[model samples]
Target: MHTPTIGDSVDVLDTPSMVVDVSIMDQNIAKMMKRFEDTRKHVRPHLKTVKSPLLAQRLLNAGARGCCVAKVSEAEVMAAAGITDLLITTEIIGTVKIGRLIDLVMKYPTVKVVVDSIYGANELNLAMQQFAPGMKLQVLVEINVGQNRTGIAPGSEAVGLAKHVGGLKHLRLVGVQGYEGHLQHLAKDERVRLCRTAMEKLSATVQQIKDEGLTLDIVTTGGTGTCEICAEFDCVTEVQPGSFVFMDAAYRNAIGTTYGNALSILSTVISRPATDRAVIDAGLKSLSNDSGNAEPKAYSSMRYRPAGDEHGILEWHDLDLRLDIGTRLELIPSHIDTTVNLFDVYYGIRNGIIEAIWPVSARGKVQ
Candidate 1:
């Protein structure tokens, strides 16, 4: 645990490099781990948000049960890093990817996946047919918990799909996964209520399957915003939260949480051609603006304006600022997930000096 003192001579290497203060990142991880310390529900954090094997290792060190990724390739990277337990939490939607899934299972041997439909289950079944006998793929039935994005509808339809997937030769329905993504960012009370309602829907489906003489083991759901609420539900056996480890301005503004800001991009001021404005080297390509807000600055009046492809214009009307051309400024990202995807490596800094560099291992593992 290193503290950066005032006037410490830490060099800003590049114009638009992504940086993580290691001290802050450890604090963030500890805070989230504390939230799950006494709870019975396990924390299987989604690694899709960070997409870094190093970050995943940090979360595992902080008591994460395992990691949940969006793609097979992301799981492969984590598997190579010695993370044996993984849950692919998205609707794996192709035949080509099933081969990759087979390869991952062969390599790690302790992997599980979530699927919503009989079609996907059949594809997985076909892929695993060539494997050793009695070697089964654990599949979790994904229920449509109000998001309507994916997953089968809760009830008999969901139970039927689970039964079909379970009855398949090489696949077994181990549990159910429902992500209440729509309610994660709502107001606290509303988020709690809506997420509970969605989980209740999923829970009922799980019970229906159990009534059919089938045993369900794991029930996973929730994200950073509704982790506390989700953990309270009796049916939810585990919580899959990712952004809590490295929250951005959007989540902070939504929940008013005190989690330490772990991720930031350090950019250098390149132009100060005018008195009331300054320009930085990072622009739209480096940071995500989908949240429709500029990076909040410590000073209230200094607003960030997008000038061009490679420049961020700072609009400050009153002060006669005297920042040098090589001044370094930290920019908070609007969206942590997409912003992280833009960078290749994150410079982990401690006490204002680079301690380590970790590559974004799953940066382009889209499929």
Candidate 2:
């Protein structure tokens, strides 16, 4: 297949090409960042969704204080692109990962991490002392604020963890990260109520840490669904909302298009096997269905289901129109993050023209 170039029409792209509506994506990024412009909180978009150094730089250029990556390997790629300010939201363990993190952090001190246990903190601190001696790694005590994920118990246990990290010569207790991930896709009313409770737990821990004379420079937490309410809280100094940049089917269904769906999988129909059903070149390997099946960009009655790794069956609820074998279509992914990881590059489009081509530089950087 011939490769697409700048100024080429999106129509020239091959099947299952992941493309971004550049105008919509730019607007999405601007809207999300502008939400915090008048507030004390800063927008530190999480790069886990858009795993591209090019896209990450776009967020930074739009007034983001920094960006967050889910893994250390991702931080390396972003830093190599001259984006050093980062926060690794996951706990880093094992000698191999700690070593990689140490090397990365030694060069880029703005890199931060979250530690849920004293053991993890100790191992990280010990590794730094041996390798990058005399330099403290900024750390956040991950608080379990209703997510039941990887975080220290809120209140006393959280305070204890923060205190221990602060006392360490090679570690600095800079903040607390208690992500309400479970509530990101919940109903709005319930999400607000539960987010309030989660913030309370996080705040109490911050208070306790402050009482012990520990530094809490960053109290960061929030996702696309709850960032609005989270920003209103005095406890939250920053919000990490990544998915808003490329709103997916799941987010659109839940959030009602507060941010436009800027990404889609461009596919071509290969077989019209039945009167009401056709097969496309995109499937589980192209668009993820963990949240639910992807939706066709148009044709409201069209329904899509993965037939296999590289094929998807599209059926219509009402046989209003027949799709030809060579017909091209766009599919909005149900889950943006996983779907983005499936593509190697995003053909940025504007008014049907390929305006830019960005490599998914950190596509598989899940270390």
Candidate 3:
């Protein structure tokens, strides 16, 4: 809620805050969308990274088909914010979550949920019939294509689930989602080879479902790492790439440094522990250490090491420049999604001046 006014200098903002370069972010969005402009595929940017509805609307305005959320609560927040079309990429089970899903469908007609089992489908169908009669929820069968996470097998298992969903009166089998999450961070050639194999499995599943007299309106898949290859596949109808808007060090290593580093933690040098080391105010609470430690921007010789909850150690090697006290340093996060959840608002910067303050509205809505 502490937002800086327009035209404020980035230095004037508080330390340990998240700031986004608006121009760079816009370019990233536009570039990703343009990659799919000529193809039949569309870009459905996931909101799990940038949890702000304002940013989601910006993506939609830039020609995104819709948005994807990881949980039902996230979908609820987006739907309440007037994002009509949304897809909850995770499966929703249990009675309470099922009721919430039904409520969400009642509120937003275009809402969709992924199902990996017939039990989940039946539970959702029964909930819809009891809570919101006459409302049909769009459902997608999640195929476990390489990522041994929360999806069924691609061939017969996927076809069986799709058939089960098709038989439900309150559930409509609209599409199938086969995410190659395990192959997202591989090198380009290996990533493409593995993704092609997975896509072939999913494509065969799509054909099998079609052979069963079922029409799949969508075949949603892919992330920022394999978006280009996935888009080229004739069977993929849409690509959901979230982290391209805010390129992090981990993704930069896997996908190459094509997009700008739009997100960074603005921190102040609080202590000079030694001649070869310094301490920053930001730590595990301010940034995410899930992928790896945050990298100091433009300081190639310096390395970041997490000290404690509120401290970070920065060690330098053969560096003549000294990080004196009160020096401001921008740390590029290692993982954009988890790092974004650590902050409440993003100080939008353009040309070294704060242009807007956008809240992370969907932050902590991870039910």
Candidate 4:
């Protein structure tokens, strides 16, 4: 299929293309920034959702402190695009990845990573010693508040890891990261309460580190669901909410935020099998199926169901709204991160016209 130019209308684009409304995205960014403007906390939006360098730079220009990536390759891509002040939210395990991390530290002055184990910290320190001697790699000790993921317990174990990383000459302990991943999808009241509990544990860990004469600069946590709650806490110096840039169905159902859904899969109706069923060109390959099927946006009664890798079935009870062979429909994906990774380019639309075609720069950089 031929690619559409910037001046082309979104209706002329190919089927199953990832589309982003630039105006709505700008509103989302402004809303997120305004949420923390009254507080002391800052926004460091995560790049895992929208992997485009242009979007990352846009977020930085909109008053975001920096960006966070899930892997070293994502950080490398961001660094090469002239984006500094990046944090690799996940730990770099092997020697090869640690070498890449060291290179990033040498190239970008403010590259940081999360360290949850002493072995990982020592290995990273040793690797940095060989590659970039005298250069300090900033580190944040990850505390497992409730996620039970890659973090130590929030009390002495966290403090002990901080001390270990602090003792290393090549690694500088910056702060702690305690992500409430499990509580992000809960209802409003329960989520806020559990988030407060998690923040309290993280704050206690910070105090433990401070009592040992260690300086903790940044206390980062929260996602799109709990950005407001995390901002209210004075201890959380930075918030890492990734999915706000492109709101998904899952996040929309969980949080009460006013952020609009700026992302959608523009699919064309290819077949009308029956009176009540229609099929689109986008399916599992175009939209993410991890969080159930994508939601139909145009018709209220239409229900989206994944048919296969290249087709989606839409069932509707209304007969007045007809879906012809060439009719185009917009679908709000359940998960934006995985859905975005399936496409190479994002058709940026504003006022029904294609404004720009942004490449998903860090799309497959899941190292």
- Clash pairs of candidate 3? none
Report how far residue 20 has shifted in candidate 4, in Å: 1.0
lDDT assessment of candidate 1: 0.82
In model 3, where do residues sit more than 4 Å from their true spots?
1-3
Q: Per-residue lDDT tens digits of candidate 4, residues 1-367?
A: 6569999888788888999999999999999999888788889999999998899999999999988999899999898998888988998899878877787889896989999999999998898888888788899999998889889998988889999999998889998898998988899899999999988898888888999999999999999888788777777899999999989988888885588999999999999989899989998999898987789977778899899899999998887867788889899999899999999999999999999999999989999
Q: Tell how far residue 63 is off in model 1, in angstroms.
A: 0.8
Q: Write the per-residue lDDT of candidate 2 for residues 173-287, one digit (tens) a residue.
A: 8899989999998888999999998888888888888999877889999999998888867888999989999999999998788899999999999999888999999989999
In model 2, where is the ten-residue run with the lowest total lDDT?
314-323
Among all candidates shown, the one with the greatest lDDT:
2
Runs in model 1 with CA error above 4 Å? Answer: 1-9, 131-134
Q: Model 3 over residues 50-159: C-alpha lDDT tens digits?
A: 99999999999999999999999998888999887998999999998887888778878899989999888999988988888788889999999889998999888889
Provide C-alpha RMSD values for all models, in order. Answer: 3.3, 0.9, 1.2, 1.1
Instruction: Give one digit per residue, the lDDT tens place, for model 1 in 254-366.
Output: 88766766788788788888877788888888888888545744546677866776788877766766667878888778778888898898888888877778889889888
Would you list the C-alpha lDDT of every candidate in the order shown? 0.82, 0.92, 0.91, 0.90
RMSD of 1: 3.3
